[model samples]
Target: MNATDFIVSRNDLQQCKSIETQPPEAAALPADALLVKVTRFAFTANNITYAVMGDALKYWQLFPAPKDFGNIPVWGFGEVIASKHPNVAVGETLFGYFPMATHLVIEAADVTKRGLRDGAAHRQVAAPVYNAYARVSGDPAFTGKQGDYQALLRPLFMLSFLVDDFLAENDFYGARRVMLSSASSKTAYGLAHLLHRRDGIKVIGLTSAPNVAFVKSLGCYDEVVTYDAVTSLPADSPVAYVDMAGNSDLRERLHRHFGGQMKYSGRVGLTHRSTSPEEPELPGAKPSWFFAPDHIRKRAREWGPGGVDMRFGAAWAGFAPKLDQWLTVTEGRGPAAVQQVYLDTLNGRVPPDQGHILAL
Candidate 1:
């Protein structure tokens, strides 16, 4: 049998690098680690952030890999084919940031450190400490119910909860309405939904004209406006702009339109591009980036694990149902199809709110 298995790769920027032609010996699993045979992975905005931001995010390039290798894009799910760790055994299916390859040997320590989610019903163990993990549901098919789809919202909800907690505790410096770009995206939608639950704050969602209705369909925002409708927004609106679209021009336009009213601006993502440094801060507003780990670390120290966990649990439970409607799945491992999907996502040609599941 041929040893090579197709692996999607990118060289630099958004270009499709090419299929790596190599033998199984070249991608060998460590003797002491479990080897996951990858079967599927979902393309979320979070992975897009990693692909695009690269070395910009803190501790991104700081971690030491099994070998002295360059940075690897960490996200995906798979099944275990081999294992030396007692906790992980042969034939156990797992999901986490395994890799975007046919098979990957993940150290047991890395699994424990990074987190993995498997379910008993699915003949696996679910360790969601690093990120929420769920049972793949009792029914084989997507049942469209909350329990049936908890995995869809777990990661996204954690981010949304973290964002809400940050804004609630921090001093916005006198900002009222929160301007959320990528309003149609799942992450942004999660934020908009959570913030809308309580009164007194306004959620202004910004997206393209095509997604305007879909964004409004979420029914969580006080106002839904298109990107081109920037000028139409209230000038000097005294608002906080939460940027989700990493487009420099849009960030500049939002800053210019709202000006001093844009009291606080947080750079959360560059979902539009697969390779670009974090956007330069907009002048005038208090600018910084939002990272879930940093926020969780600080809060965990101050509030302790119990308090933070309880709060986060409630937030996750609240947004659980809404997430199901936002996911889209695609099958096949055709080189051309995967290439097109990657290019489309990088170019912002894909719909902002829809999630993509890639079947390998």
Candidate 2:
């Protein structure tokens, strides 16, 4: 069998190139290894965050990349074509983080009935979220589901689930109104939907004027405000900002407008990748980086395993069904399509309503 891998520029992080070669044989494997046939995966702004922050967060270190080149990480489904481990078997459908390639060789450790964590030497210190992989067949949510939702939207929604839980856990930092930049983004919208379901606080969607209509149509936000309309928001009322776009200029304008009334600001993603300006002094709350894994671990400890599940499960039950109403899932296959769509997402050209699932 043969394999293909895509590596992008590590220094500039601009371009991606593909390489094809013979895949590793399963005849002789490590004592405990699982050879997964990469089936399909999702790519969106979320995946772009991995590449942009690869060096800072060590995304490049997770699945090894060639010198001066890096592989982008994605969440997707794979099948275990061969396993040398006693616990795992061939033909098992699994879900986890994977590089854009034909197959991945995982050294499985901390094996469980549901699945196992990738125990590759390089991954030991990485976040457990990426290290963990699930046996989809054993899970009810994915048992009979197609690759559409799970591949693309589910991962983003998970972050949304965490952000919503995090904000509520902290009582939205004493603000009754929440403003979400890049509100049209899947993660932002997912969070907005969860926020809308709760009482007391108002969920306001902030996006570009062109996207305002689409963001409004999602029916998640209580108010839809365009980026140009930042000053229009009430200065008298306090608000918390959940930032997804990572645009510094907009942050400054927001801080200037809301001033001391801006109770909290949480930075979530960098959908606008190249525009990080120095954080200038501002009157509002300082923008804090919202790392989803930290919150996930925190809640898992605070709520216990099942208790955490119950909270997110109850939220997902209310939000998942409404997804089909707004999202139109599409697939991009082969190396050419993968590369093109990667550029599209990185450039922020992909429309909010079209969800992309890639098979390479």
Model 2 — TM-score against the truth? 0.96
**Model 2: lDDT to the true structure:** 0.86
Cα lDDT computed for each candidate against the true fold? 0.61, 0.86
Candidate 2 has which clashing residue pairs, if any? none
Tens digit of lDDT per residue, candidate 2, span 1-360?
Answer: 879997898887567888985766898778889899888888889998888889899998987778898888889988999899998989998899998888898999989887799888898767888888988766667643345677677778889998888888889889999999999998999899889888998999999988988998998899998889889999998899999998988998999999999999999999887665677898889888998888888888888867866877687777778877888888879999999888888887899998888888
Query: What's the lDDT for residue 111 in model 1?
Result: 38
Q: Backbone clash tally for model 1?
A: 2
- Residue 1 lDDT in model 2? 83
The residue-by-residue lDDT of candidate 1 on 161-255, one tens digit each, is 88877887764456668889888877788899888975678899988888998888888999988888887987755788788877678878878
Mark the regions of model 1 whose C-alpha exceeds 4 Å error after superposition. 1-11, 17-31, 58-74, 110-153, 274-283, 306-309, 334-336
